[model samples]
Target: MECLLGLLKVKVVRGLNLAICDPLSHSSDPYVVIHLGQQKVKSSIKYKTINPEWNEELTLSITNMMLPVKIDVFDHDTFTKDDSMGDAEFCILDFVEVAKKDLNGLPDGTVMKTLHPDKDNCLAAESHIKWKDGKVTQDIFLKLRNTETGELVLHLEWVSIPGITH
Candidate 1:
């Protein structure tokens, strides 16, 4: 008899969707979190799945400046203690700089220009950056919203690390 080895590799990027297969069929109540320095971060989309014999694909929204992202998946079964597993070391993605440009439409237009853009939206739009020879340069877009007024306030701009294109 011969032996077969399988390896799993996952890449965590901004404004991108990722999938993780359920390692066990017993239960699927996995959650992921990110860590930067001593800070712990949570995902924007949180859900539970009852699907068995399959994996879960999740779309991640660009969060605030959190680096050295650490992913952990936890499984809670009905009969056993919660099983914590799945950890991956994400590359150190940092917020290099930020800028802003005027919205592309006229002031009196009906479709209304970006009321306000924030750093997060910038990262989402420029998801595919240029990475060559371990160097990267790119811009992200963000639309800022006012919590009290419920209006678009400003536009956000951001750049990624040299090696992290887009």
Candidate 2:
């Protein structure tokens, strides 16, 4: 295991047009799982909604800043194994680069960086990393890949350990 450099705080805000894993009920009990390297963390399950509003915060100990953080949505089950809704991954390196910038004089909503959708990512639309609420954050609408349809709304923030410089 590598030395922990910081904690990547992820807010799984909500889902949009998520896959209906429960066929009989025509809905899904959705939850999110986040991964960095071999470490994984899961959010609380939001029951019976295709557009579930999680608004849950989960954190992962990040050692390497270059690795992409992976996100997967699953439908919880009672008797059987949980079914996968879809998956997406975001590059922390991108966010970290912008976070290192001096935003002290910038306005609250000033756009720092604009990232467009690409084959390498699941971004549903253009993403902007900016300073909000005295923190550096990026809100993303990730278009889940490898299934019919789904989108996830996420807020990502990087918090470095105090007195530790990477």
Specify the highest-TM-score model's number. Answer: 2
What is the per-residue lDDT of model 1 for residues 22-125, given as tens digits with 9 covering 90 to 100?
44533246454545445455433323442212222222223333344345444445578655434443322432221122233423322212222334332223
Instruction: State candidate 1's TM-score.
Output: 0.32
Each candidate's TM vs. the true structure? Answer: 0.32, 0.92
Regions more than 4 Å wrong, model 2? 1-3
Locate the minimum summed-lDDT window of 10 residues in model 2: 157-166
* Number of the predicted model whose lDDT against the real structure is largest: 2
What's the lDDT for residue 155 in model 1?
Answer: 16
Residue by residue across 1-166, what tens digits does model 2's lDDT show?
Answer: 5877777789999999999988899999999999998899999998989999988889888778889888888999999999999999988887877766667777888778889999988889999988887778889999998779999999888786777754
Query: CA lDDT of 97 in candidate 1?
Result: 20
- Return the TM-score for candidate 2, rounded to 2 decimals: 0.92
> Which portions of model 1 show Cα errors greater than 4 Å?
1-26, 43-67, 77-81, 94-127, 130-166
Please give the lDDT score for candidate 2. Answer: 0.87
Estimate the Cα RMSD of every predicted model relative to the unseen true structure: 17.1, 1.5
After the best TM-score superposition of candidate 1, give how far the Cα of residue 91 lies from its true spot, in angstroms: 1.8
